[model samples]
Target chain A: MRIVLMGTGNTATVLGRLMKKCGHELLQVYGRTSSSASALASELETNFVSTPGDITDGADIYIIAVSDNAIANLAGELKLGNHLLVHTAGAVSKRVLQKASRNYGVLYPLQSLRKEMDDIPPIPFLVDGNTSEDLTLLYDFAKSISNQVAKADDELRLHYHLAAVLSNNFSNHLYTLAEEYCKAKQADFRLLLPLIQQLCLRMNRYSPSTLQTGPALRGDSATIELHLKLLEHMPGIKNLYTSITKSIQDHYRRTDN
Target chain B: MRIVLMGTGNTATVLGRLMKKCGHELLQVYGRTSSSASALASELETNFVSTPGDITDGADIYIIAVSDNAIANLAGELKLGNHLLVHTAGAVSKRVLQKASRNYGVLYPLQSLRKEMDDIPPIPFLVDGNTSEDLTLLYDFAKSISNQVAKADDELRLHYHLAAVLSNNFSNHLYTLAEEYCKAKQADFRLLLPLIQQLCLRMNRYSPSTLQTGPALRGDSATIELHLKLLEHMPGIKNLYTSITKSIQDHYRRTDN
Candidate 1:
């Protein structure tokens, strides 16, 4: 499949590499910045372009892997004849690319990507297309790189994206706060790695609520109070701690009743 | 070393089994309920006792692996002559066991343990002892079961415990909330597992603050507003979503400034 990768950011770099690894013909790489576009294009052995107007038109798919805010504007600037156009965004609607092409879709990979990761795990691509034929094409393209591919419409994709935010973004922030707490108290942050790893591994076997353990889940008010006292210096963490505790407690209380 | 396992709950079962596996002589298992106590004791090929008064007097160490609230009271009930007494609790102070024995200490494992895990990972044991000589004995015992061991005082342990709460308990609650959202929206929750696993694995290489990604961290309020709108019916999740988004934004704002 001939493809054009339309960004040089994290998603673009990772996805472009995966496509090339799967023996797809990456025709060109385009980005607002010439340096990043040229760098990725060089690595993929593809041509490079600086602007959306300069993007070549003969590719089977034009994947716009830019920022969410940039997707619509970039899509509006490009006109990819009968070739499929797709945006690799979670929150953005597939219709946003309709202005750019007759055949537009979404290729949302539900993962927080890092360009430097040597071994990207099997990513689950949630795909959507303007038509049945286009959807089949996208699924085949997705299957070429990943075994985990499924059809997800705009509405369901958004909800899954929201869940991704909770699972990936919010959870990573909590790790940031945990690292800060450990550093402040002369405790090794690495000590928490086994616990964190085990917690995620347990999710595979048990429902998270069933595996939940802590002062908040146990309703130990005394320990909760102590944790609040411990976070007195960091108001942001304190507020987060308090709110999440209340949410967890409230959820369990409602479920029990 | 002869050891007495006090309490037959999750921690006791797992830790007792680990100690026995490491070739330590588990002298007795003590708990309020004879059934649970005998069950674990039988597994460890040790005697069982229903009360603290019946706890064997000659063990080198008595590990009180009960709930945090029960630790102080349980420690007070047991009088172990000059033998070392330790409680496997993060938030509780080692001093709580001073009444039970002159050589009282702490052997807190900073991990979310489940009794059913056949192969336990090397757990990080945060040890605290009243005396240097006593600390050596505890360290040696900890080394038998785990390669990771460190001396963390009460205040430090509390901070580490606070960090663990954020990393493990609070994060697991977010997963629960995410799973709830997925179930409500008819999206497969299993699809989110790879993303979750990759996020934590990224933590091993990057500080979470640096690895953080999402609409919130990107300062994408349009997407945030849409998510908030989508979460309108689930007020508990909505509030959590709003507060965490604000916190992530605030963190980046501070770091950038």
Candidate 2:
């Protein structure tokens, strides 16, 4: 299948490489800038196009892998004829690509991607389409490159995007905050790595709420007070600590009863 | 070294098993009730004692692995006669055991422990002692059962304990919330597991701040607003989403400059 890859960011580059590696024919690489388009095209052994009018026609599929804000604008600019067109975004609706072609859909990768990463992690693709035929096409294409692929409409994808933010983004922020706190107190942050890894391992087998541990879960007010006192100087972290602790306690109290 | 394990909780049982595996002599298991003490003692192939007066004396170390609230009261009942006494608590100070014996210290395991877990994860022991000799004894004892061992005083251990809560407990809470959200929406929560695992793997190499990616970090207000609307019915989750998104935006905004 001949594919036209759009955008040159992390998601774009990684997905483009994956599709190419899976034996998809890359007809052209498109980017807002000529340099980026040329770089990606060179890497994929394909032609480069920067202008909307210069985008090659009759590709089997055109994947618009730009940022959420840019997807609509880029889709409006593209002319994909009747070829299937898909945008790779979790939050954006597949309808965003409807104007670009008769067959439009989504190919959202539900994992973080970095072009510079040495190894590509497992990417679970959540797909949707304007039609059943196009959806099947996407399902097949996604399955070719990934073992994990599922159908999710815009609403479900948005829900997943929110969950991803909570589990991945917010959790990583907690880690960042913890590392900073460790550094401030002159404690070795690396020592916490094993604990973090163990938590991840436990999550695979048990519900996280069942595995919850710490002063917050134990409702140890003395320890909580000590932690609050320790964080007195750092208002932001302190507020976060207080808010999350309360949330945890409230959750269990409501659930346990 | 002959060891008298106190308490019959998760920490006590797991640590007792670890010590026994490392070839330490388990003299007895002490609990608040005879049945609980006998249960743990049977598991450890040791004797059981419920009354404080019945606790065997002259052990190399008397490990008080009870809850933080009970640590002080329990320590007061113990008669160690200069035998080393230690508590496996992260936030509690080594000084808490000083009243129990002439030689007192702490043997807090930084990792979360559960007696029911089939496979024990790496337990990093944080040792603190009142004297250099007691510290050496603890260092050797800890090194016997675990590869990762370090000396951290009360203040430092407390700091790490707080950080552990943030990274492990708080993060696990986020995961729980996310899983709940996924279940409510009928989206497969398991799909997000790869992303969570990838985040953990990335943490080993990069600082989490550098790895953060989301609508919040990207400052995409449109997507954030959509998520906020989606979470409107769930007040707790909505509040958390708003607070954490604001935090991510604020954190990077402040640091990026």
Candidate 3:
């Protein structure tokens, strides 16, 4: 498939490389920054364009992997033909690309992708298109690169994006909190790595709810009080401890969770 | 090494099974609940005890894998010799076992442990004792099962526990939120499972700080405001989203993260 990839950012770089490696022809790579765009273009052996107008019309699909805010404006400026156009965004809507072309769709990869991600685990692409035929084409293209592909609409995709934020972005911050607490205690951060990994692995065997343990979940208010007292030295961590403890208590109080 | 495993709960069952599999002698499997104790005893082909008084005296190490509040009481109640008394808790200090004997220590496994864990990954065991010799014995016993064992003090172990709460408990709650969001959208939660798994797998390649992404971390108040407005209809979710968003923003603003 001839693909004109958009943007030279994290998602674009990773996706473009994977697509090219999967035997898809890279028509062009577009970005405002020539440093990244040109470098990525050189690597993919494709044209590097800084402007949306510079994108040619020979490509089968236009994958816009730009930031969410810049997406609508960029699509409005692009001179896309009836060629299938897709934006790799979690929050942005597909209708934003309608002005650019009738063959518009979404190819949202529900993962917090990074350039340093070496072995990109099997990504699940949530796809949508203007028509049934276009949807089939997008699905096939996504499946060629990933075994995990699903057809999702605007509302469902937006919902998944929220969930992604909670699981990926918020969860990573939680890990950071753990690192901070460990550092304060003159403890090695690696001590908690095994536990973090095990928590994820346990999902394969049982629901996280069933596996939940600790003072808050166990309803040991005595231990909870002790922990809160211990957190007095760190004001910010103390607040977080109190908030999470309250939330856990509220959950159990209402539903016996 | 002859081991008398007490408490046939999640931790006890896993540890006992692991120790036996590693060619250690399992002298007995005891628990407060008769059904659980009897079941584990039958599985290990060992004696079962409903009380700590039924302890197989003179065992190399007596590990009290009970709740924090119960540890001190249980140790006091147990009519056993000093030998080496160890309580598996991060928050509870080594001093908690003072009633048992002078030969006391802690053998806390730093992982989200449970009996149903399919493949118990190499979990790090944080160990400490009242004396150098006791610490060595505890460390050696921990090392017998897991290669990832470390000598940790109570102060450090408490920090480890705090980190565990953030990484394990807090992260799982985020997952719960994601599941809740999925239900609201009438979308199958399985669609996001692959994405969640990949996020975890990527940890090997990138530190979370380097991979942080979202409206909150990106400093895009525009998208965040939009999300907040949309979430206003859902009071519970809206509050959660607000707190987490504030937490992330505060984190990045301070760390320049």
Candidate number achieving the greatest lDDT relative to the actual structure: 2
Across A138-238, the per-residue lDDT of candidate 3 in tens digits comes to 99999999888989988778887777777788888777776777767787777677677777766765665566677788887776777777788876667
lDDT of 1 at A127: 94
Q: What are the per-residue Cα lDDT tens digits for candidate 2 across A1-257?
A: 88989899999999988988889999989899999999989988989989988887868888989888889998887777798999999988888777789999999999999998888799999999899999999999899999999999999999999999999999999999998899899988888988998888888788887888888888889889999999999888998988898899889988899
* Docking quality level of the chain pair in candidate 2: medium
C-alpha TM-scores of all predictions: 0.96, 0.95, 0.94
lDDT of each residue in B99-203, candidate 3, tens digit only: 778688999988766676666677799999999998898889889899889898887787778778877887887776667667777876766666667766666
List where candidate 3 sits over 4 angstroms from the true fold: none
Off by over 4 Å in 1: A51-54
Q: For residues A1-257, write the lDDT of model 1, one tens digit per residue.
A: 99999999889999998998999999999989889889999998989999778887788999999988889888888878778999999888999988888998999998878788898777999999999999999999899999889899999999899999999999999999888878877778888988998888878888897988889888899999998998889998999999999999899999999
- For model 2 the TM-score comes to 0.95
Full ranking by lDDT: 2, 1, 3
lDDT of 2 by residue, B1-257 (tens): 89999999999999999989889999999999999999999999999999999987768889999988899999988777799999998888888778779999999898988988897789998999999999999999999999999999998899989999999999999999999999999999899999999999888898887898888888888888988999988988888888888788778878889
Docking quality tier of model 1: high
- What's the lDDT of the predicted structure labeled candidate 1? 0.89
Q: Whole-model lDDT, candidate 2?
A: 0.90
User: For model 3, what is the alpha-carbon lDDT of residue A239?
Assistant: 76
Candidates by DockQ, descending order: 1, 2, 3
Worst 10 residues of 2 chain B by lDDT: B246-255
